[model samples]
Target: MFLSTILDKPVCQPIKKPYERWYTFMEKNVEFWLPDSEWHTKAHCARVLLLALLIGHQKGLSEEEKDALGMAAVFHDSRRHDDGIDKGHGSRAAAYYKEYCREHGLSYDAQTYYITYYHDQDDSLGLSEIAKSSDLSEQAVLLYQIFKDADALDRFRLGPDGLDENFLRTEEARQLVDFAKDLLQKSNETNA
Candidate 1:
């Protein structure tokens, strides 16, 4: 056949180097969590990390903030038990991250854990209020928002029009939805 049915959608292949680094980190640290059913697999984590980093960079987040965000994205769904809604998964993932950091003698900022622990939970408090009450900087709040939105953008894995642009936190993130889905589809093909 000259054409394939799956070739209909555009694919935005992300730059290799940065994703390679994140992939390596996941392979080294989260091998156990990588293999799973569709919704919460390594591919999902990779896409979220890529999108979160892109948003963070565009928003002028410091390198430290980017690092934390990346870590948070990768680990956010690591503890998921199934594709259905699972409570306490985020907490378990955050605990895993802490133990992983400790064992590796690496230090992560508190925002990293906060993001990881709350990624799946939609908090009642606004970001500004949370930022004001906590020790988190504005940049940290931005990172958290980007991390959450990046993950949400991957709702394409759920089916048609699964990503709700209205919930997207930043303009950059909202604009990247199609591109992000393209990248994610490519990633899934490679992994499959």
Candidate 2:
């Protein structure tokens, strides 16, 4: 909907049921406010969702597991929509997930309050307070790793108009640099 308005692409037909409503709700609710110029927008969220779904599917997660990942991807930035400075965005993401589920009659197990907020902090900072086990596990710290990767892949536009490292911060983020580079090379070959 909004993406069609932004990109001039043909509007995507909504999915059959809850996904349709969920997407419509997201379109209505999410603000275009990007925290930084690098890449933060509804389009960015969509890209991450796509990537998250792809990864979850490729890794063979169950329907519910995939759903949890999807839930996380959708609500990841719901906080930034509120424009609050004191409440951290990730923590807000967790809170918003709870509220969104209750209001919409969707189901979600566990929560992300701890992971989103403290995922970036170092061990020396102290034991991170967890409100509950995350619906998604970081797996060798790989959930965050994958999430960071997906976000980077979108920001760097690795497959198409690709993103650069200017905005990427983690070692995992840096990994996508080569991916983008490889894609660029392949594109050059295809064009030539």
Candidate 3:
């Protein structure tokens, strides 16, 4: 589920089931692409997706924009076969996204493709070659940051010294990292 809090204020929005359809879709398909590893579980993808939605909302992104970012978050690492620094996982996942979209008769967006393909690499704007090739829009760049920061915020899943605030992109994301850790802990407890 996407977060309902905006700037730490709890809003009265109802739980949007369709917003969660992305999770349902991925849950059914992830096993085909993702490794059976402790670090790349569906739970981790869920946390990253929810965090991306929260950050996107805080950045004033529209629902459609958030949905695109949500897609990237859920599918970004699905191509990893190993938990440890799988270098080309992002590219593979991005390719899987295309295949999934084609097979499912859904249209693929190039911006989402670029964001998901490079989510694990350097900062969105740090790679001059990628930046020039993608010709990313301002919104795409912001969405990329939101997606990357959201995933990074869940580093607590790695271990005690997991989350590093310096890796977080936005100030708001840094503020929310602890909350992400709490969510991870509670999720683990419940699942345990």
Candidate 4:
């Protein structure tokens, strides 16, 4: 079934299925940096979270990797000031994620931090930095690519020509283009 089907029903209605936990968690927990933003709201984050998990699963990510991806998805845009190319929102979101995890007594994953911190930056620059950091594992680099691709998949919300398949980091993400467009359309309908 299309993932968008879940949002077709009332937001309060229970959804019992795979990935439902993340869906519920995002609905209850995601806090937008620009709460009133037309483009960067909870719905956008939730869709990214779902896309990340789907791509992560296809890439054989471990539970720990998936955890980092989930965190990155929810917080990556949590600090955006506006929809227009907010250059450093990723870094702000990364800092917020660190503080949030600390306040909640959750373990802070560097992979998550790096992914969120550099997601909005240029891919070559981000990967170059990751390559130079000896502390970051190859898995961190993979997660970064996966997380970015997940975020990119949701670009359909920006309208036609918003997403370019060649820019996606993973073939898995490329495969989801049609589904992403459908999700955005259905999500808009549900919210409207």
Name the best candidate (by TM-score). Answer: 4
What stretches of model 4 exceed 4 Å from their correct place?
Answer: 1-18
Question: CA lDDT of 10 in candidate 3?
Answer: 53
> Which should have the higher lDDT, number 3 or number 4?
4
User: How many Å off is the CA of 129 in candidate 1?
Assistant: 8.5
Once model 4 is optimally superposed onto the true structure by TM-score, how far is the C-alpha of residue 26 displaced, in angstroms? 3.4
Better of 3 and 4 by TM-score: 4
Residue-by-residue lDDT tens digits, candidate 1, 1-192? 111222233322332345457667886788445365767887678778777777777777777777888788778888877788887788889999999889889886788887887776775443544566566766667777888888888898888688878888789898887777777677667666
Tens digits of per-residue lDDT for model 4, 1-192: 225575444431322243566666656766776989988887888788877877887888988888888888888888998989999999999999999889989899988888999999999888988888877898888999999998999998887998989999899999889878877887787787
TM-score of model 4 (CA atoms): 0.88
- C-alpha lDDT (0 to 100) for residue 147 of candidate 3: 86
Off by over 4 Å in 2: 1-25, 28-38, 81-87, 111-144, 157-192
The local lDDT score (0 to 100) that residue 148 gets in candidate 2 is 48
Residue 79: error of model 1 in Å? 0.8
TM-score of 3: 0.86
lDDT for 139 (candidate 2): 42
Report the C-alpha lDDT of model 3 over 89-144, residue by residue, as the tens digit.
88898898888889989878776788888876777343443457645666777777
Residue 164: error of model 2 in Å?
8.4
Best candidate, lDDT: 4
Give per-model TM-scores.
0.84, 0.54, 0.86, 0.88
Off by over 4 Å in 1: 1-16, 31-34, 125-134
lDDT of 2 by residue, 59-177 (tens): 55555654555566666765564433334666667677777667878664553333344433442331234323444354424444445455556644334545655544345445445
